[model samples]
Structures are given as C-alpha cells and as structure tokens.
Target: MTAPPATPTVAVRLVPGPGAERVRVLAERAGLRCGGDEIGPAATVTVIVAADADQALRAQRTRGPLLFVCDTVSPEGRRRALRAGAVVVGAAELTEAGLLEAVLRAAHPHPSIPYPELSGVLSTGTRPGGPPAACTPALTARQTQVLRLMAEGHANADIALLLGCSEHTVKNVIYELMTRLQARNRAHAVAHAVRHGLV
Candidate 1:
C-alpha cells in the first residue's frame, strides 16, 4: 500500500547541432522521458539547449538548469555556457557516456543541510551527552584531501593523477563521501561539504 516513487523528469531542449538525436537517445537510456513528450514542469530535471551564446545567457538568466551541447569548446563557448547557468557543458563530439553522466549529475544535485535541520542540531548542542553524534562523520584524512580537489571541480581522471591513485579509487572515494553525506550527487555533496566547513 505504499505510493510508487516518483520518476525523475528531464527536459531536453535541442541545441543547434548535429547531435540532438544522440543526446535524446542517451537521456532515454537514463530513464528520463522527454519533457513536452511526457510531462511538464514540477518535474525535478529540466534539460534545455542553448544553440548560441545569446540563448545560453538568456536561459541562465531564467535561473533554470541548462545543458550546453556545443559544436566547439571554445573559451567563449565555455564562458557563455557558464553565464547561461549551465551546471554542465558538453561538446558535439562528446561521447554518449560522457553526456549522460553530465546530465545525470545535473539532474540530481547533492542534498543539503537545510537551516531548520542545522538549527535543531545546534540548539541541542552538547546537551548532557559529550556531543551529538556527528550527522556526517569527518572524512578520513585521505578522503578530505580528495574532496578538496573535487571541490575545485577536478575530474576523476585528473584527481587520480594528482593523488597518484587509480581513477577507480577516486570514484570509490567520491561514492563513499556521497553515501555518508546522503548527497543526491557529487556537486551537491561538494556544496554540502563547503557549507559545513568540512572541506
């Protein structure tokens, strides 16, 4: 007698490029049905396309999450995408796997400690007990090091190289960190760490 869990919704706006079909295919594989073709807003993820810098900027101003799939990765393109409020940007040549990963990440941002949650914890500070059990345990020294680099937006491959570990190890650490923090995803977890002064 429990209600079914809501499926995450993703909106995909086709940017001017040859890869629109490819992007759509990737999204479908991720269990995200097309927006207009399926549902409406009030959905968790909205995928929008910005064909050019101008459109991208406008999309950003609207304060909606965007996916900037461009034909090139020029500095100007990157700047425009970021300015357009894209949390992730990709190129036409980007592999389906890469684009899908970026989209998934954008769709599921990490969970955060809301003011009410923090307030409740702090107000009950130290009580008769030594200290309230840490809601998020301090990351191990190594995990802390990895998280700092992650916060700087380094990819797993780059982080692995920097830490002299395998990319798999970096991924594992990231997974563990997210699990411990109950983060919805990596970006959210990083934001949470930063907000909590954990990293």
Candidate 2:
C-alpha cells in the first residue's frame, strides 16, 4: 500500500490581536496545519508577525524556514532577516494566496540560496537558465522607499500622499528605478527590488 502524504506544519508567531486572528483564519483557509507562537521542530514553516521585524527574526533564528509579516521593512531589516535564516519577508497586506505560496516555497526552498526561497517573493524578471541580473549601483534611500511602496501596488498619487512628496517626485523615482534596473516598467522595478531584497 502507498503511504499517505505527510502533513505540513506551519507555526504562526503572532500576538493576541486582530492580526493574529486574521493570520489564523488565512492559514486555515490555506489548508496548513497551523500551530501556536513557537515554531516546533516538526514545523515546516514559521510565520512571524511583529511590528519590529528584527525581534521576530531574532526569535526565529536557527529555524528552517521563516516568513516575516510587517507593516514596513527597511533594506537593513531585509538583510538582517536573511542573515537570521528567514526565507521570505512580506508586508502585512499579502493575500491569503500569497501567504500560502510563501509557505509552499519554504517547504521546498531553492538549492542555491541555502537560506530561504526568495525567487517567488522577489520575482526578478530573469529568463530561466540565464544569470541573475544585478543592480549596478545601489538604490538611494528615497528610491528604496518608493520601490517598496510600488511593490505594495501603491499608485503615484498614493505614494505621494504617503511619502509626503509631490506626484512628480513619485513619478521621477519610478522612472529612475525603471531606467537604472533596466526594468520594463514600474512593476518590473518593484519586482527587481523584491528579488534583490532591497525593499
């Protein structure tokens, strides 16, 4: 007789709040075997939600795969999470489908990355079998901010409002990111930033 498929375990480390309830609902909807605050040894993925992502990352350090959910994450935070062995870092706005995908990728991570799977999270527009592209210089602080907002699907007007800048400035940042990254458009620029973990 064939053996039954193993159930995947997901440990959700969220405080007792609105976000915790939402995460629980979503994880159940995704058909994941959801657990509580601590990521058990049998846990395939750890979903951590914290206002301070670094704190969550630190706590989840030495785990297998981790997905961090936060309102905002700086580039430094991204590096810190990666260094601490997180597989994917995401915004609080990630859809249920997106969260499920993150969990799946964490279960079967990329071999080259060795840390966590980020290709799906970042979505760099590279053709299969081709070398991954690199950002020639580095993105400025403002550009990083704008690109991060873009990743969240914010429009120029909304980005302007959030950044306390003019629409023109937002447009300029998008244009510059596209040009610098050789991206086809704003979405591509955001994808590049995501793939590179710059945002």
In model 2, the clashing pairs are 122-194, 122-195
lDDT of 1: 0.55
Off by over 4 Å in 1: 1-19, 49-55, 58-63, 109-199
Please, what are the lDDT tens digits per residue for candidate 2 over residues 43-144? 567677766557665556445667777667654565455544454445666766767766665565431232223333444333222123453447889988
Which one is best on TM-score? 2
**Which 10-residue window in model 2 sums to the lowest lDDT?**
111-120
Identify the leading candidate in terms of lDDT.
2
lDDT of each: 0.55, 0.60
Output the lDDT of residue 97, model 2.
73
- TM-score for every candidate vs. truth? 0.42, 0.46
Q: What local lDDT does model 1 show for residue 162?
A: 95
**Tens-digit lDDT string for candidate 1 (1-199):** 2222225554544443355677667666655555443454343344545465444555443334456665444444443343333543545555545655556545554423333323332333222212124754677777877876766667899999999999999899988988887777776676565445455
